[model samples]
Target chain A: MKIHQLSVFLENKPGCLSAPCRALAEAGINIHTLSLADTKQFGILRLIVRDWQQAKTVLESHGNVVNVAEVLAIEVEDKPGGMASVLEGIERAGLNIEYMYAFTIRRGDRAILVFRFEDAEKAAQALSKAGINVIDSVALYDLVEKG
Target chain B: MKTEHCDVPFNNVSAPDFLAVAKLRELQLQRLQCIVDRAYNHVMHYRDAMEQLEVRPEDIRSLDDVRRLPFTDKTALRDNYPFGLFASPMNEVVRVHASSGTTGKPIVVAYTQADVDVWSSVMMRSFAACGVHAGDIVQNAYGYGLFTGGLGAHYGAEALGATVIPISGGNTERQIMVLRDFGVTVICCTPSYFLHIAEKAAEMGMPLQDLPLRAGVFGAEPWTENMRRRIQELTGVRAFDIYGLSEIVGPGVGIECDQQNGLHIFEDHFLMEIVNPDTGDPLPDGEEGELVLTTLSKMAMPMLRYRTHDITAIKTDPCPCGRTVRRIDRISRRSDDMLIIRGVNVFPSQIETALLAVEGTLPHYQIIVDRQQGLDGIEVQVEVTAELFSDTVKELEALKSRISHAIDSTIGLRVAVSLVQPRTITRSEGKAKRVIDRRTN
Candidate 1:
């Protein structure tokens, strides 16, 4: 019902964003989805990777502050209103969504939407009740590997 | 001849203020002998130190023999704790003051009524040196507590027959209001805090230059001359540096005259010396080294050759302002590991103490000191457990703020707290380098 997301702290320099990506790529860790939250001085690079532990180790070895957070990864329809429907269900459940990013699954005509919520467990239950497919860590890793 | 555009040529034209070099040395010798005798007969710590040197009080026959005395440092005060260094008994003691003791126990000093009078007179001289006169309104913004800045300036203003507003630090809006309503003419605070006040005034759409403030007596921390220029440019006030420590006396140890060149040490009250910090050898005038002071007039706690750790040189040339007392250059750096952040003396161990007291924080931390926009900024980066790292962003932010607040309470200086992942801080082999002072660069 939850997925592991890797967050790395980066100073707002020219090559900060690429540095982490290169580190992950060199470590053979595939990034499933990413969303960047930034301010004037620094930025937080949030990545949902197939091998999050390896991604964290690689980033930390590069002197970056890395944290692993549990988030919900849900598979939604690839149509235009797919993300909107999932957000509507989350809004109705009173579970706030901090941020979300999406990536397409290789085989199915669906997209994987990674969500950070105030309460991950509550968000997962609310999405499940709304008949949405909540993918666990193992299933999400498998899909990313397949891609 | 008086210098043009100067407020006053000299604050006091008394005999000692304009004493000839030979006569001043004679007076210093007499006073030095008196304090040595007082300390030897009264304070046991001084007696033990002197005994260890096998030197008698009467051995200080000449000014050069004064070096035969033992040197006192901060550790002496710590070992004695509250009032072990007082030459006068507690029953006769009139007041007590202390350092923040952020790293450990606070160093306490007591003063008798006569010593308090001496402190006030020196403070008055300090204000007058900056051209602050009687009938002026003084706003004393130094924090009043165990810290000595507030009451030290407060009594000096009162003794100078100036109206004093005892508005301590903080409450920025109220400070501005008083600057306007009370028509403050002189402000006493740290140079950094004064700039902060000026910034706040600008934020409130008020021009600090338009206020009646004319002079600012800033001390209790080291500030650069460029900062002084910025302060003068912003507030249209003459910023003068006042130097002192609780171990010596409070805020009136030395002050810059209208010359604005260097601070004039009140030679009549304090005997000043500059010695090599590493070797303890006395350096000649114009040579920068650690400052050593001896109380010539203090009755209760007469510090004898106390190593101040503040690094500066003395200027022996006579000033055009007609004062014979030598002036010390602005303090640039300390020989020790003390950091003056936002005008508060901070040590890395103090931050470590605060961080260790708070839960969820590891022992590893680094102190980063930088000068941002002509003011000192401190950031404490602490490594926390991975469990705390796995917490939600909101919780992590709360924890960071909590650590910051805890450190603020401990050191009385605001600092940015960064909670990093465990094992992120670099480990040291020999002596751990806890401070990164980027301000010097």
Candidate 2:
């Protein structure tokens, strides 16, 4: 299963985000899933898109210190307790969620969650067994096109 | 009964540890004979090299035969790359380690299983010379795997019958925890790392004196006598220098004994030579020149007359502790690392000596050399300790000026001063890179 995500390590500056976004636009790489994990002076732009490798190549060629990691992409209902339930399922499966960030939403009470866990395969299986309609990229693209 | 202690200082006994001396000389000759015979018989490189010198194995009779042969440089090692220098076949080689090539591409050297045993024995002497005993546990914090520091010390400490704790560098908290729980009595690490460990121990309210560490074998970088005194004082343990290179062996080709005098060369396993680096002519004893070594017992890759670039005096005078073999003083400096700042010779070791002498700053320091306005100038960026910087503004300024003056008085070269925060300079687990030569690159 492919989870198209982006990781951009940017030094804090006025036009840091603009340069990366501008780079993505220049390369014609669209950002489908995006969230910013920020610290005091720097931010990591977590992203999910159609082509993860292409996005990484485009950003890296522009001279950036970046890294790519394997993560789970989850589809949750656009409701208040959607995230809490998925996390509880992971907890029930004897797994821990290291970190998570929200990407874009497709439609009607449904959102995309980018998650990192101690064990990625196990987490995905547990969420799948919990009757969660976890959509992969093909399904996600169809949903995006439909909405 | 044959320890170095029984020998007298001024007896002028023709043999220093007559047993060790005779055994060493005999092994040295045998290894030399084998090397020459191996070169003439096995590899075409040595044959061509010796032919170019117009000398043959038959020409060499005694130890002096080494002079007739040509010296090997890093370029030669690179040209043959992988295993060009090995006298034995590549299949016989079982291990390999490399030096950190800060200057250029790293140089690789190979070792056989027998060669590995030789290296471990050398390191065993390195620890034993520093008072490491069989009953104690050893915490080897030297980086493991590709780097020779950890594993070199690792095998040697284990050979000495000490409980080996292979805690490869970093994670100071966990390192300290293991040190306390296992009651480690010996530490093997680079000098800079030991200092950083001491700082961490102080921060955690851990009484370092209460720990069981009695001695440490420190190497992989050149350190000053003053730095040695500071490490001994801070960690409450005796520390000694273990000197070697991957081209020759790792961790122990020679070692410093407890007297804190100088590193005793293990002449049995390896033969050392001092020569003028530029001219390549052998220097007389006690002359400070570039150090070169030829492996006698080396099997996989026998480095024939390799230049070490380290500057030190070799004293064969029987030490007070009674080791009759040659002992090298703490490395004065490396010819490669010598920075000619405005016609003045500047070395990091000298700067370390001066900085340790001064009172106000922490050990973390940087030398910023800049070229501007068609003239060169040097600036020393030192970190201020909380104890010294917390006083008053005048006191802080005074500290900077005082450090500048100390440097000036020592080197007779003026340098500008800039004070930084504690830990301002990056702490390195390996050799600390302190010099910022912005003059050209």
Candidate 3:
């Protein structure tokens, strides 16, 4: 199972982050999780929102260059070794994780870990075979909406 | 053939080219008086400037009296704009050419039929000086449109009875193919552009030295002796420097004889003077100063004591080629703030305009000019605002691209845009230092 993530290009400037966040909020699109990757000049804001299309539309209307990327979102136990166990399975399956971020669902005891892998489809199959509970876009949107 | 054997007096050398010192001075004095009288009678700008100096046309008796004339700079040209400076009426003006003005309005120059003939003859003399003959196939690579370089060289090559390919600048692969296929003998363009062609030829597995090209009449921008040697060594072409300005006459004011010593100023057509740039006082021979030119033969627009701002000394010593017209050393530097990047004149102010148009960029920026692979490279390092300093990599990259595109569209030159950290650029208290040029030889 794969999850759709919104990757936005942002100049490393003040109010650049808030502009998109405000736009998405005004559009009534809820962001489930966001992680920022930055260099001195610019940064990439990766986000998982409840409505990807609406979030992209609102951001694009604000003159932002937005793109969609497929990632693996899996549910893991909110325990110390939970992330380590999933990463070890990914490593064993020869899949490399580009970056990852996590957020806990208020309704469940488990944590939602979003991972961007070099090959998302291959990682999804390997994680599924490894007995990891991979959440698809529908389930991920539902979880985000429930919160 | 080797350059040493080809080094000889051009067949088109006129009587003025062989005038003795006394005769040359006498001719200059007579021509100076005629032009001064013409400018005073025709052009109001020159008349007012002369009247302000209280110097009448009759006052210019000797060549030394040229100092009494008011100095005309680029400001005068800008003030005159389109055709205000022309001495002749519109019907007499046969052609018009202009400098690429990235900062403001382009400097416009007009040529009458007589003026066109004079330009062609002078170009022919320049080509002949470089050992180009009637049978030689001249592949002109200088830009043709508004700039005087392309058509100027083309007319001259044709006047010399040489077969001109008339191929304008750029298109490196095609330039090489034409060079090989046509067996082009003489190449004409800026020294830097020629070097680029040589590099491209080498990349295409056809080094220029093996080509049939024999001579190159290179000008439009200042170049070095080392660059000449490198061009000759790589392309096996004897490179000669041809000097001219659109203000006086484009691409035919002076040319280097086969001696490759100094560019011989065409004393009969244009009166050349060396003057102190600051004081406007004349400097003697062998003393370096700003070059002032008065168009003696130009009919459309006769520029009187027009300051060239090119720093070089005149050589009175006789050249081995026997051309008695005095030679000015090859120009390597300019007294003005203009920077010639890839044959296009760029001012620091032009770069500022380009930067201010883009968002998220601070006013603080530095233009760095360097020579890489014998071609000019410009890098605009702009400071990002504190807010934008933390933007995503993709956003910053987009900003950089936008800036680069703006500058390219504005100036017609490609530049690498670098987004530096906020407050990283040094603040200057006095004059804001905008340019860092390391392309000097």
The 10 consecutive residues of candidate 2 chain B with the worst lDDT sum are B1-10
Among these predictions, the greatest TM-score belongs to 1
In the range A1-147, model 3's lDDT, one tens digit per residue, is 787788776657898789789898888877788899977756678888867888878887776667677888888777899778988888888887778888656337788888888678988888898888888888777777777
Q: What does the lDDT read for residue A102 in candidate 1?
A: 74
Off by over 4 Å in 2: A1-147, B1-23, B101-104, B338-441
Best-performing candidate as measured by DockQ: 1
lDDT (tens digit, per residue) of candidate 2 on B223-311: 66777887777767777888877778876888887688888888877788899988989998888898988888788877778888888
Residue B212, candidate 2: Cα error in Å is 1.2
lDDT of 1 by residue, B1-441 (tens): 112234654455233567888998998899999999999999999999999999998899888887999999888888888888888888999899887564646789898999989888989888888888888899999999878899999999899888999999878789999998887888998887788889989889988888878889999988888888988888888899999998899889999987899989998889988999999999999999999999998889999999988999999787888888899999999998888875577877778878877873556778999876446899888765544453345566777788889888888778988765445467788444689988752
TM-score of each: 0.82, 0.58, 0.76
lDDT of 3 at A123: 85
As a whole number from 0 to 100, the lDDT of residue B245 in candidate 2 is: 74
| Candidate 1 accuracy as TM-score | 0.82
Native contacts recovered, each model: 0.10, 0.00, 0.17
Alpha-carbon lDDT, every model: 0.82, 0.72, 0.82
Query: Where's the lowest-lDDT run of ten residues in candidate 1 chain A?
Result: A36-45
lDDT of 1 by residue, A62-117 (tens): 76777777889888778899778877877887888777777656438788787888
Please give, for residues B54-157, the per-residue lDDT of candidate 3 as tens digits: 99999988887888899888878878898999999999898999884535467899999999999998888887776778888999999888789899999999
